[model samples]
Target chain A: DAGVTQSPTHLIKTRGQQVTLRCSPKSGHDTVSWYQQALGQGPQFIFQYYEEEERQRGNFPDRFSGHQFPNYSSELNVNALLLGDSALYLCASSFGNPPSGYTFGSGTRLTVV
Target chain B: QKEVEQDPGPLSVPEGAIVSLNCTYSNSAFQYFMWYRQYSRKGPELLMYTYSSGNKEDGRFTAQVDKSSKYISLFIRDSQPSDSATYLCAMGPSQGGSEKLVFGKGTKLTVNP
Candidate 1:
């Protein structure tokens, strides 16, 4: 089965700009979550999408938002990006509730100049 | 304090050695624990997961969870060079549909041949 897949493996954008990253969850999975991983750090949860609605969110600011399409694909949008936004954007998929059967994509490396 | 705490170790061990990685959490409500392995410039891949307290083994990897102490561990036996990567510990509450994961700073391991 195909694992979770993310688009634009790497991208560079200027500060104050906006960026959009995409993700396709693994087959048979319906929930999608987004995470941010800084260099030499573990990922921090951004938010989670289920049933096409954002269900839970982390401590991130409003500049970060996400959407889960009907087909279970997801998109993470970051507006007014700062240099600190330069990190690996990871997309994860799970069958239902997470902490089980969770899979992650290779992630999109966002570099804000 | 962070909900989860893990040593960001650049742990170097010779090949074929036994390696133990661990994380401690302050949240007792976290019922599901997971271990993820991430290579450089790549997203994390789930290595093992455990619900509540117990030990689960897959091949040379063993995951142990102690609910009373709120500690979790991942052990690798006969380690190989390919096992060199950052290991992340993640946990979430018992919610069924919209559980969000809290991750610890990853521990980097190097298995030198």
Candidate 2:
């Protein structure tokens, strides 16, 4: 069985531009959540998608958004990216209402220039 | 104060040495505690998890949680160079409600051969 997979292992974007990172959750999982991990720090929750709708969000600004497709894949979109937005974007998947434990992808490294 | 606090240490130890990592949380509501290992440029992989307050062991790794003190620890015995990575501590509330993991800054460990 395949674990979570993320596209474009590494990405480079310029300021004011927008970028979208994709993720396919592990098989048999339904819920998807996104996290931002800055260098030298732990990951911070961006948001979570369940049932194709955003269920809970962190303190992130509105510029960070996400979507969960019917197939349980997820996409994280960051608009008007800033230099500070450069970080590792990780996707985690779990099953059902309260995720027992999350399985995370390798993550997409976003570099803003 | 941050919800979770951990020392970001580039901790170095000789191979086969026993390693101990810890994290403290300010939120008493957090019911589940976890430890994740992340290699450079990779997403975190769950290493150990515990609920309630006790010790859970898996092979050379042992996880201990002290709910009364709001502290959690991960211990590695007979560590190897492959064990060198950043260890992250994460916690969340019960699964029935919103499940969002709050993570610590992570402690980097290097097991030198």
Per residue, candidate 2 scores C-alpha lDDT tens digits across A15-104 of 999999999999999999999999999999999898899989988999998898999899999999999999999999998644678999
Best by lDDT: 2
Q: For residues A1-113, what per-residue lDDT tens digits would candidate 1 score against the true structure?
A: 89999999999999999999999999989999999999988898899898999988988999999899999999999999999999999999988543365799999999999
Model 2 fnat?
0.83
Error of 2 at B29 (Å): 0.5
Backbone clashes, each candidate: 0, 0
Off by over 4 Å in 2: B94-96
TM-score for model 1? 0.96
Stretches off by above 4 angstroms in model 1 are: B94-98
DockQ of every candidate: 0.76, 0.84
Model 2 error, position B1 (Å): 1.1
